[model samples]
Target: YGPRTERSKLPRVKVAEPATPEQIQETRRARAKAKTETPTLKIEHKVPAAERRCTVCGRTDLTTIGSGKSSFVNEYVSSQLVREEHVQEVLRCPCGSCVITAPGAPKVVGKGQYGASFLAHLAVAKCADHLPIYRIEKELARKGSPVARSTMNELLHRCATIVEPISKRLLDLICTRDVVLADETRLPMRNVPKGKSKTGFVWTFGAPDELGGVDIAYQFANSRSGATPRKLLEGTSGILLVDGYSGYNDIEKVSSRRRAACYAHVRRYFFDSLKTAPIAQEALDLVTALYRVEHEAKEARFDESSHL
Candidate 1:
């Protein structure tokens, strides 16, 4: 009876209703003050002007000499070039004997509408920014450029061709490297015809050899067959850090091989199976323990630098 009386004596509290006008105005002012207290960020882009001038005497004086068929007096000079806005102009000299010619402006991309810097921006936007070409074309139109998607495609193709030499050299470096990591990811080639789901594969190889720095190579292929690894890594040797993909097994000829699997991949499979598989929780616990070990290793300088 005493416990029941004490429980009944306890008071109940109610939740507050909507704020009054004064409180609302105060809240709005507080928010405005917070916004004013924060700093604003601004971005700027600058493009350098293109110009040409004389190397010697630093004078703009120039003259054109051409190979007008020379019998003995009136001669045409082959050195004469068609004038354009890109071509530099100089003050004409009376005598055609000595002509100080300014070399034509260097082109980032030759003949094509897009410049070198523009191609670079486009590549970064596509690869890093994950923007599709169609979106980029729309953006260009918004900026008054009105660039076509086909033009963008041509630009990308030309850029890829131009950089192929560097890419090949990097691939060669990767091939020579004793330590390497190789993997492939699927890319949907949507341009292909219907019912043909053309699944393209992107092969990435990385790490360095006796030469110097790390080199990465990416190749696109129509197939992701086991033989794909064999084709890309022919005559390659040493440690190949990769995911648990059976396709890599076709390249067993790799010398002094050591396989290090991605722990994240193993964790992902166990996590996905956790709902149905009773043993999945146990596997997850083991993976969590491994991750804790990795975390501890990262925090504490446990291993010697050479062993690391």
Candidate 2:
């Protein structure tokens, strides 16, 4: 294992003729199961409505008085966003200090619509549903409230500005956490300063800490280079779980910093192999071993805290 010696190419072994019908059926079933078996976020229970009561006074009495539902119909876009409109006025004040008024719907985007709730729905639509403002405006016009696309864009920027402080705080907590998972995904952003039409990269850092569980931070950079991760993780010391990218190697340059390879990345190679060269069963088996280890670890509920 010192100096690698080149090996002579072995004669390619012919795989038995293409799988039979039965074998193909079995492969189909296994692939379907493997695709469906990927782990996902598990939310156990919803927080009780009673739990939202005021902490100062034990008043479990709260009721919604006026409620209305609005339908925003757009014939142009093949999407319909139906939302409930609510007007709730709380009856009791725990300490008699303030009367809590929670509006039913948002009216910010649409003139006749609910303000905060509307803004919130629009924000969620933009962020989660990935809908552009012009489309949303057209959708709103069908419902009677005509919202301008430019206004929607400004609203989003305002919302982002409002939440940026919270994002910075959470990001700070994440970067200072015990262990962090670092990765980057491509983001399409205009780099006008560089006078180029190329897209920017969004460096993502997911860190877990006892204080705030997991915090995800994203930064848009002009390029995907080692310097980005190096700068983000500079002066940080922890095990970084990342895809085996050379960019992460720069972390080791900082004394005492460690890196762990993502099993998902290793599994992806097997998937690619299955698609490109299905006959490479030996390589497939090696990848399968990696999945087996991950499965066993998950079943054991392996606590990464031990490494702390």
Candidate 3:
């Protein structure tokens, strides 16, 4: 009875409504701004002559006024695979001494049926969109252009070969930057020995726009050993921000590279320990507060001294 009476006396906190007035006003302004900022092609619709007659007055003639009410509608255009045929012409002089022929059209894969635009779309679909080659084959079949999976794979390989030089240039540029973010993740290699799969690592290196926007480079290696990144970053001298992976220790020790631990990784450890250790919750809370302060500083575009 005592516990029940105490529980009853405890204060009941009510949950407030989801949105405040300021938030509602901000939402309205955001919608209006989106409408104004979005690029739109205005298409005017006119009333047909048959429907333009007035039903009440039985008048056959009608004219449009200053302006009509406007409404916006979203639309979509489906992607399609197009086929193009190029014809080369040959010419012969009247003397029959010489013959001239126009040069053949350029191809992504030399002497191959695919064009540069087709190869570009195929590469973007497979690499950037993460679409499987088998699925792309199915999609192409549905579009009345059935390209075999093996053929697509060959084309993709050829495209990679074509762009290898550009990729190398990007890597060189990234290595020259003063600061880089590095990480690695496991990738599975299919059809390994004994009909099994093998684990591979993809090492990613990135530099932001402030660091000259070198873009990101991905290097795949069979092993997650320290030597992989050490070799890739051989001549690079800069600060590397990475998670606490002992693989990077050798790079830091041997090269002119400074290693900085990722704060998000530290916070992740505290977050995982919260269930077992109550003190970890306090650390997590502090980290969350720090993130909030950082967010506010970024939103306000505060400089280093101002943030401090």
lDDT (10s digit) by residue, model 2, range 1-308: 15534222232443224546886787788887885676444334434886857678876665644453433332343334455657588765788887867665545344544356666888899988999788889888997668788878888887788788988787777766668888877777655799767767878888866653667887767888888878767787778889977877878786356888876676556555655676655654565555555555554445654321
Query: Which stretch of 10 consecutive residues in model 1 shows the poorest summed lDDT?
Result: 1-10
Identify the leading candidate in terms of lDDT.
3
TM-score of each: 0.60, 0.54, 0.76
What value of lDDT does candidate 1 attain over all alpha carbons?
0.68
Q: Which ten residues in a row have the lowest lDDT in candidate 3?
A: 1-10
lDDT of 1 by residue, 1-308 (tens): 13321111111223234556886787789888887666554333322223334667765544434633332222343221123467566655788666666776676677655566778888888888999999988777775667789888888888888989998888877766667788888887675557565668888888864445467788777788766667666776677788998888756665446667877787778777767885777776676666655655544434433232
- Candidates ranked by TM-score, best first? 3, 1, 2
Best by TM-score: 3
Tell me the tens digit of each residue's lDDT in model 3 across 1-308: 12321111112233233556886787788889987887788899988878888999989777777888898886775667777888889999999999999999887666889888888999999999999999999998998889999999999999899899998787767766778888898888785567988888988888765633348988788889988778877767889888999998887766688989987889778766766886776666676667666766654446555833
Candidate 1 lDDT score at position 67: 33
lDDT of 1 at 29: 90
Off by over 4 Å in 2: 1-114, 190-196, 209-213, 267-283, 289-308
